[model samples]
Target: MGTTTMLVQCNCFDDVDVHANSVIGWQQTYDQLGAGHAHTTLKHLTAERFQIFRETFDKRIVQIGAAPAGRLCLAMPVCSSEPSVFQGKPLTGESVTVLHGGQEFFVQSPGGIDLLCVAVDIASLETFASREFSSADLCQLSRITRLDLEPAMIHRMRKHLERLIDNALVGEALSEAELEEQVLEFMLVLLDSALEWSVGRSANSTVSTYLVKQSQELALANQDEPPSVLDLCKHLNVSRSTLQRSFLSVTGLRPVEYLRALRLNIARRRLRSTETEQLTVARVASDLGFSHLGHFSGAYRTLFGETPSQTPRAR
Candidate 1:
């Protein structure tokens, strides 16, 4: 059996402010990129169908914001110059945030490289997928969720969102039932994703997660240090057998391999996003604790599918 749900979409830039008072629950979600003032394009997204409420062509929105239905939220930003929490984090995961909550995505609208964001709502989803999975499972699955960006999933979801935007742009119409189906699929994907995450978490033993997480922290903290397997046992007080099992179970890599991957992943990011940084094959290999240069190149090439010197770097 599956839970039933529906979605209401609005025309491009349709203003939902007038009904702000009527719609008991609305979140004022808008962004001017650190601007504290209000933008004209704020939208009040709700579960109710939009066609019923909006009769005019959408041009009213100078800004758009969506809050959960039956819940009210105000759109505002507090200025802070602090670097983003994700500043040093690798661009491996597909990031998602809520419409009206403690975290709201801020983007430069009408299309900008730095401001294009993909928005998804988990609550709006419902479907029976791979039995029931737990929150921990989802968190685990979410681990690879970012690491291995599911291109197929991304393509499907992107198209769906594109259609919604297109429909909004052209004011396209759909049957009442069809509209519901769209929302259903949207929610199903959401749940499916969560379920995938759950399965990932539960796939490994509790001990594995702890060791992997700890090892990851240590690796990041001492990227230059060669924290050998013996060091791991000394710090964590676990035998080689336990450490090997945990590493193999969660990340499927030995400590050396894991460190190599981590180093390359970091170096790759620095190459792509940071200012002029020389990560020559030998330099990178040595930094990652690979004593032999030849082996490092082979591993790096195999892992990233690119030669060390060929990495695209930007200042």
Candidate 2:
């Protein structure tokens, strides 16, 4: 039988219950604060060798658990600002988290998470690794910590995923085998690259990056009432200069600017949502912490090249 692909979109926390029947068989529980709505887009590609899923969730605290499906799963959080706890350790945006199918692990994301998850059947992946090196070395892969991947590499991975999604949606049998082979090759390449980065990483750099990620998570979790720079510094137990430096190094934007951008994006999404079509531009601005409507509109226009009112509501 040829591979099967499915795309699913959910608009609220209650809507995610249907995902239990997915190939990965995830059991999820979510806690949503305020009147904010949640949105999710899930694309699943399943073939003989492996299954890959592109999942995105907006504005929800979710806990996910799944039983062993005899696969080795690798998850890359693509635009995740908040730190997710996997197996009790906080995972930042810089690493790809791996999970052995037999070993159950928990994932908790505060919100705004985009993940690319690839699950290769254990037997198939073992056979592929045997050709690469000693089969005994495959055991070490299970113990591997989060693997570092550069931003450029992640961007390219996303582009590849988009192509795969497009191809899957087209439902052409002629290129199905070729597309599967490409996806397998890409997964192998990612594994190889991750192995290389796992060997030698500096302690100092890791700590700095973790701090920056924490700051980001804090800022994102409190979007409705963002903290000031001094508040952040105090909460993180770091000096203002240290916080600023960390934000610059990690996100290339100051803390305030990053928070502003995040709020603006949230407003934009709400404006475009069909469920929130009744929300006016002024309400969105005030709810997102913009006291001056004019300033909010100007900033929104500068960032998105259109005023908030210009954004069309989703039908």
The numbered model that scores best in TM-score is 2
**How many pairs of residues in model 1 come into backbone collision?**
18
Every candidate's CA RMSD: 18.5, 18.4
TM-score versus the correct structure, for each prediction: 0.33, 0.53
Considering summed lDDT, which 10 consecutive residues are worst modelled in model 2? 6-15
- Whole-model Cα lDDT of every candidate shown, in order: 0.44, 0.65
| Candidate 1: worst-modelled 10 consecutive residues by lDDT | 71-80
**Model 2: residues with Cα > 4 Å off, grouped in runs:** 1-14, 20-24, 27-35, 172-174, 197-315
Off by over 4 Å in 1: 1-204, 274-281
| lDDT at 45, model 1 | 24
